[model samples]
Target: DQQVKQNSPSLSVQEGRISILNCDYTNSMFDYFLWYKKYPAEGPTFLISISSIKDKNEDGRFTVFLNKSAKHLSLHIVPSQPGDSAVYFCAARTFSGGGADGLTFGKGTHLIIQP
Candidate 1:
């Protein structure tokens, strides 16, 4: 069974509006959560992250919120721009590997920014 899931395959948002992407996981062993933004063929670039201990983390226009009780997390982008149109993946990993272990990634949600 897939440990992580992104139920929404795609989302459309108007420029200057907010974009929210959702993710869920069933593995309680995961202590670290990360969001990655990817273009057409390039590798995924790190977006934001939040530890299981913290409920939220923000950087610039990007924010990641974690709800350990519900085994869910979400990414919020304020004032969505055309450049933000890309595939976003939610990833999680256990802290046992000292940050060396491979991350379990979701299917990814394709975000489209309406110009």
Candidate 2:
């Protein structure tokens, strides 16, 4: 099954504190990984990504680290802000598709940053 699991349903963090979210996968064929941030009623926006070839990727306030051996990955947001309060989805692309690209998404993790 294409189950990309985000075990936590929500997290609350104070402003200027670090927030971490975790994800796990059951399939071994997955090759590409992505983290997408989403607001209510809007499409999930791509945040960070890493291929099977890389173990870590970072962009400004966001960092995603993948550990293939453990079948897991984590996203870290340093000094989380209220603006960061939103649902985060963990997705993966293992292969191409007919009408869509490789994308299997988790239910999502809600991150709340208190100002």
Best by TM-score: 1
Off by over 4 Å in 1: 97-99
How many times do residue backbones clash in model 2?
0
- How well is each residue in 1-115 modelled by candidate 1, as lDDT tens digits? 9999999999999999999999999999999999999999799999998989999999999999999999999999998999999999999998674455689999999999999
lDDT per residue (tens digit) for residues 49-100 in model 2: 9998999999999999999999999999997999999999999877656543
Question: What are the RMSD figures for all models against the true structure?
Answer: 1.0, 2.0
Listed in order, each prediction's TM-score against the native is 0.96, 0.92
The CA lDDT at 71 in model 1 is 99
